[model samples]
Target: MQASDRYRLSASATWVASVQMEPAIGAVAANLARSIELVEMAAAQGAQLVVLPELANTGYMFESREEAYALAEPVPEGRSSQAWIALAQRLGIYLVAGISERAGGRLYNSALVTGPDGYLGTYRKLHLWGDENLYFEAGDLGLQVFDTELGRIGVAICYDGWFPEVYRRLALRGADIVAVPTNWVPMPGQTRDGAVIAHALTMGGAHSNGLTVVCADRIGTERGQTFVGRSVIVNSQGWTAAGPASVDQEEVLLAPIDVKATRRARQLNDFNHLLRDRRPDIYDEQSGATAGLRQR
Candidate 1:
């Protein structure tokens, strides 16, 4: 059979899509509308799971804490989260998108997960980057894996990908796919020809932990801060399945993945299983020492 024919015959394959778009600063209504539109388009193309960029509803780069608070809302009950939930239910698909969350007077950079059944869960950003610390509280909920009909889903936003422990923790919790809602910025000393460091970091995390990673990043400039838009989807083997979209365009990339395959691949030829081979005792002691030093 031809490759296309074989693909057509695979009933177990699931299609995942990443949406890369430019969000207008403080334009919640318009941004939500555009995101819903793009998700609809992806669903029409057979995408069962869709991921949107970080701060997708509320653009990044807040000038002050007051401004950030003005844009934040309660999750699942928030307007943006409700709209995404409605869209997911209407389309019979799973959706993951970022939002500015306000809870008990504190604002967190967060991502929400919704599916055909309605609201699922939220992941607060654990690592704040640059000016983000000025406005948003660091994540308190820690890493979370949501169980859905599609598979076990995990969520991380932007800078969380920088820490391998985030991926390792999720993978250990049986996460088959990790959805990253990110607003990536150019790193210091980055060159045009060089590979996107964020993308490389994601692939390495996925490969090392035997997990599928889907990143959705935004494009264009917001409040003079430019975002790097190269939304990518990596299979469990750490290979690009969909895209590293253009640096400045609205695009959707779709790819078929088998979540179960990732579990099998973790065995890695018996000699060196991804999760089985461990020297965690030594690392844990070292980590404790480092933490103690930082406390001093």
Candidate 2:
């Protein structure tokens, strides 16, 4: 092999881990400004990419389905996403953010990933938790992953974190990291001071899938509901680079990540190798009952 070829292969990986936690139920204009402020700050701090909390532009709690509908907006065409794309271009950094997305005539909780080049891609929340079913429609699309200056990354909105398979599928398909933008409601009867369940879900998904998982969430009380804002970054080994938690203020959180570590971990443990070891021959419930001549 040529010396230049070896040098290129050995080039160091450059990336950043960052999150923005918006104050819950805050005014739209205020939230947007805070988000923009953080975007610029993260870029100045050397972040190649930044992720803001789920529904960071709008608070998560709702009084009725109509309220959620009122907050929803079309992607790229909507005010919130348009601002995000423009900001990404301005800062020349990749951005991942969650928003209430409007489609056709209904709304779906969704996440969008944008790069300096332009708006890159989006993913809608596929698994709606209890109360969410009452307001948002579940997205039927499969997991999405895209290439960025940092690395190949996948986006999964809130409830999607509970299902480890989502991360597994993305990692198997070549995602080096997964970004989760969430508005995590505390479990049934747990006190806010108790160990955060959402962080556990995020770390579990990352460790099991052999990838780093970064999450951003909103904080403060909104419409009679309260959230424990602990926006965090977790490594493939399930360790928190930041603490166990943080508050829901309009704050910028940053950490450094080594992309090469993700590849090495996957090669060593290969926890997600199950994607290739599946036995489809006996898994017939997915389609025709009689297997003699299954319909295409």
Candidate 3:
């Protein structure tokens, strides 16, 4: 089948990468090394923007907060963050990789966005899942988008993908793409489309928000917790642009993402604009007057 025109023929598309891998518990150095190796592999494959899975530096499922604190390091200054930044600098590409962030007395789950020039910014996970709350404080940095030469890149981690508002806010703030660093667990049910139900959430977010999503998920069983890998890239129209990589294997998925195309797609037609047509005045979920939903 022929590909639909999502981008202008004249505009350059950036090749993006989603890397899925299993990280060992407490193997900080080794995990960072492996993550870098996977990123380098993606770089060699002509990927200009690469994303690694959540907690790629320190394994998820920490036994205690002390253990997590001991392993966590300050963002940008930490060895893991610095190493990823250095790799992006050396490869002359952009990267978003998850790390365990230590700031003063708190530890938060974070994704650091780095580019060829230097460190860009960090997006701390806004929504914590399962035992993450036990080891890390809820992210206070808010959902952040980094402006880069490739495009405006936003970030979200594992559980954050579950909230559609995360993507909506990013898109509202002018994000062209969202890099999801996730350690997705198996949902109870499967979808008819050959992907897990969790995959639907990411795709739905992309479609609804008009944001291209690059999700990097981890595989294998960790401390009795099993992760559903299937790393994927969803285009603005909610179609699978690249992978839903293997569920139990280390892998890299790459696809061309044109931000200009995404922007144009948000128009839908001459009379409608996806973001411009929003009725925030009618969506006062807090009051629950005209809206059926309530803010959590």
Winning model by TM-score: 1
**How much lDDT does each candidate structure score?**
0.91, 0.76, 0.88
Clashing pairs in 1: none
- Could you arrange the candidates by lDDT from highest to lowest? 1, 3, 2
Q: Can you write out model 3's per-residue Cα lDDT over 1-296, one digit (the tens) per residue?
A: 11124234324878899999999999999999899899998888778899999999999989999999999999999999889889999999999998999999999999888999989998899898988889889999887888888888999998888888899999999999999999988776753236687678988999988999999999989899888889999999999999889878899898888788899999988998989988776774544345544343
Error of 2 at 261 (Å): 2.4
lDDT per residue as tens, model 2, 1-296 = 43245335545634444565654453667777788887787777666778888877777876678887887789878988999999999888889988888888888888878989999987888999777899899986679889876888988888888887788779878888888888777787777677788888877877766788888777777777777777788887777865445655555566556787777665444454524544556554465345655644
Candidates 1 and 3 compared: the better one by TM-score is 1
State residue 77's C-alpha deviation in candidate 1, in Å.
0.8
Residues 247-289 of candidate 1: C-alpha lDDT, one tens digit per residue:
9889998888898888899988959899888667546765453
| CA-RMSD of model 3 | 3.9
Model 1 stretches with alpha carbons more than 4 Å out: 1-7, 286-296
| Whole-model lDDT, model 2 | 0.76
